[model samples]
Target: MNTGDLHLLTGAYVLHALPPEEHADFERHLPGCPSCSEEVRELAATTGKLASAVAVVPPPVLKQRVMARVAAERQAPPVVPRQSRRGGTRRGRALSRFALAASVAAAATFGSVALWQYQEAQDARDAARRTERRAADLASVLAAPDAKAVSGGFAKGATGTVVVSRTLDKAAFLASGLPNPPEGKVYQLWFADGGSMRSAGLMDVSGATGAAVMEGPLDGASGIGVTVEPAGGSAQPTSDPLALLTLPA
Candidate 1:
């Protein structure tokens, strides 16, 4: 079968509705097609949820009526085959194939929608977790007993603050009102202890405001400086500091 036809079977395969021969063929094709495999998994999960959430029970008399009809049909005389109706047989087969294709298309559409919803939900959850972590980190810095704040301005519109916890050995840079860097340049932080300068970290100042947290031994640094450096930042300061703040003695 063509790839499109094989993909159409994913919904049926997930529900265990495929014939044994087709099922085996799909299973073999699955290892090489990640798209089909993921579709099957998502559809299976949706099916499981539907099964668990809905309970259905037929009327007790329905079974008796079905059996009675079956008996009546079995007792009726079989119709003789019409050999001259070859064209009718072909037309009937064509109709059957069309119906089967329509059903497969509908099932595939439903499965694709379910998969998209599942992925969107997953992405939302991940974003929430990241936001929570960032909030917690900011709160911890703000609540620190020994936290000290330093502020400075770089260019005309650029300004920022550095919050440091001497005892906790952590520092956070909150930058705002900074212009976007020129191409192939980025803002970098430096810790100067009078004798030497150590790279604190790089800052992503792509927007009007951004923040970066530095964790390490920051107790001895006498000053914090910000400068524009090459994209990834340099091991040593290659440009004059655009913004500087002196820590308390």
Candidate 2:
């Protein structure tokens, strides 16, 4: 019922070999346990891939061969010694609780690792999707009859110009006057259409004049915005945007 036991059964669960009672218990637990569910999902995905890579069928004589090997090795001495611990009944109960707690902690650690890996995989997939969308937008812009290279800058100390040309399915964001981010922080670029925003990429603000070029299919995109975010940009902007450029839609 706890995480450690779930971790121990992850492989067997993926293989559909868990005992009926344990399998039912896990099904009930997984819905409320995000970490364990994530691990199970990732493990299942991995095992599915492995299954496709190899076709393994035991040979017809495998049972006979296994029996022969077992007979030859049966002569070996017992590896594990049989021993019994001496303890009070109360001490034994305490030990049982200790073991359960330890198992839970172990399961939590494993669940964390598995969830982290799954997140990495999900991020990679999102990035790929963004790239594809960007490409399509650029292609559309470049195909426009009036599309030509245009350059513009801010009215005050803020500076930079974007080269927008319908001849190419892409736009370049060139800027300066942005301050460098503090440790563990980053400048993030965003694409805005009327309804929502999407992360373009994390920008480096270490230099006086910073330029992060984003190439994506604009697909009726209205403008570009930049903000200070954590190391990785979020799906939604949390603070006021540092700069905004109206797209030559």
Candidate 3:
């Protein structure tokens, strides 16, 4: 996906309407692009609200009243529309994607917009706080004075890189083009030390890529490794590391 179209994807991404790869690409794009991230935050304000809100059953007579009213209303005359080619332009396609996403979001809350908006404001504030803390930590890792990067090829086409910073005693991992593990499995990160692999954390491959600031301190860790493990991870890797990158002392 091109950068131009990405600017138009915040709505669809929040709506979960984008395809898997496109979704991952947009996620990789988020941290670097403040405008796009802010747009996602704004568009996602109502996300959890929809799922958590209790469903209110309408009165049994409501449907009948609406049907009766509809039956009495006059039907509009049908007019054939002219055929037009609007798909050839780039901007038009992007706009169409955004419009469709916006329409879906709008339709879900059509009758309760006022009440929903009031509720969404609170959720939005909470989401914003969490996003800010994550952004701050990520910024620190990227800006670390002694940061160094080690790249790993987990698969033929996949690239994984671990950036460790001695100055901040922190490490961060980023990978793209990684295939998801088999059913009931997930990719877990490890700190290889003294011939032992201690779990760092699990890699989230829900998108086209995965990234995280490695858990635990960077002390005495010889290297970082990736492995396919059971869903919740394991005390020790049951298989060989797909990529074992020795960290610089």
Task: Go through the candidates in order and give the clash count of each.
Answer: 0, 8, 1
Candidate number of the best TM-score: 1
Query: Which of the two, 1 or 2, has more TM-score?
Result: 1
The candidates, ranked best first by lDDT, are 3, 1, 2
Q: What residue pairs clash in candidate 1, if any at all?
A: none
TM-score of 1: 0.51
- Once superposed on the true structure, which residue ranges of model 2 sit more than 4 Å away at CA? 1-156
Write one digit per residue (lDDT tens) for candidate 1, span 111-131.
456666777888999999977
Model 1 lowest lDDT segment of ten: 72-81
- Go through the candidates in order and give the C-alpha RMSD of each one to the true structure: 16.1, 18.0, 21.3
Q: Model 1 scores what on Cα lDDT? A: 0.68
Worst 10-residue lDDT window, candidate 2: 76-85
RMSD of 3: 21.3
TM-score-superior candidate, 2 or 3: 3
lDDT of 3 by residue, 117-230 (tens): 766886899999977886687679878888888786876688888888898898888889888789999999999878788889887885668888888888799999999999
Better of 1 and 3 by lDDT: 3
